[model samples]
Target: MKSKDNFEAVLFDCDGVLVDSEPLTLGTLRDMLAEHGWSMPLAECTRLFLGRMVRSQSALIEAHTGQPLTDAWMHAFYARRDAALHAHLQAMPGALAAVQAAHAATSGRIACASGADRGKVELQLHKVSLMPWFEGRIFSGHELPASKPAPDVYLAAAAHLQRAPERCLVIEDTTVGVTAGKAAGATVWALCSQGDADAQHALRECGADAVFGSMLELPGLLTPPR
Candidate 1:
């Protein structure tokens, strides 16, 4: 286990952590797929695409349907989804508070390590008023060689934070993210926004240092040991 006091920076995953946008985005993707005559259940769609980038999801769709999902199709889907997301999105419970608290404690070293493209992540954060909190502290996996379940994204965030991997704490909501944090040598705290006890257990098994039901509990959960 990582020593609690070892961490000097906090890295957050954006989608399900900073904002409750997963269901909305997933729904939009499902709708887009349906328009092309490819029907997919919400749960199944989420299972396949939840921590992946839009480009990767498009590839997966192409692979599954044996039909090309062109860049134009992805661009159209993202444009529509971004508009809806901007209109309807809100922060997850305690998300802003947690970010504030972590920033105060870490002296402004809180960073976002998201699988989202840089432009879209920045826009969403800006829309929700979380942009300033992460100013100059965002790391997009799209810029890295690999995404979650790989250590690149988290490592990049840690590097940008000027903190050692073992001295970074990652706040994440998915099993793949927990795995990636651990692989990057960071202690990971899993948030149970997905409401799946099985998934929470899987996160623990995959190496989350702790799990919390909501970000409201994260301050206490992240307190350093004396």
Candidate 2:
């Protein structure tokens, strides 16, 4: 909404995009799965569940185990993983600075649209001092009828923020996140910090408008002069 900025709003995805919690999340899932008659490697878990919701994850697990995962089992998995993330989640490198830069440049028109539940988003944002930047503007994928790789969260966020989908720029760190952003008709900028040229190339194939290695590059990319 800034007179000078080009985009109407910046939509952010929380986990790898905001916090350095993807490793923690994947690690916890791997351990929890190992306890449940399967042992998923960290790599596989990241590939399957990064930027996805609990229900999608349960589907993967059920497919892997060849049996339906009970509601009780699914809830317990989330409970254990949630406890682990609550204890030690850190913001991504330059996350606070990038958030501040975005708001300063755009007149506070940034919002979060993540596959995480509301409680998890709140906790992670507060832990890293990014809460004030988003506050009431956070949109959870859990709030939608479907989560990412679907566009529901991003579309809902743009609606809530009073912006058109095309006028919002989405920041994400996974293919699922990128797909969701693009599906919502927003330009997606993927942060593929964990990958090399080949990996970043794959991200581009997933529909990232641009790809960068760190959060330090985020604010500049989101607010290029018109």
What's the count of clashing pairs in each model shown?
A: 0, 0
Measured against the true structure, the TM-scores of the candidates, in listed sequence, are 0.93, 0.91
User: Which residue pairs in model 2 clash with each other?
Assistant: none
Number of the predicted model whose lDDT against the real structure is largest: 1
For 24-128, candidate 1 gives per-residue lDDT tens digits of 898999888877877889998888888877676666788666779887887898898898888899889899888988887788888999988887789879978
Stretches of candidate 2 exceeding 4 Å from the true structure:
1-5, 223-226
- What is the TM-score (0 to 1) of candidate 2? 0.91
Tens digit per residue, CA lDDT, model 2, 205-226: 9898888899977756656567
Model 2 weakest 10-residue run by lDDT:
1-10
lDDT of each: 0.85, 0.83
| Cα misplacement distance, residue 140 of candidate 1 (Å) | 0.5
What root-mean-square deviation over C-alphas does model 1 reach?
Answer: 2.0
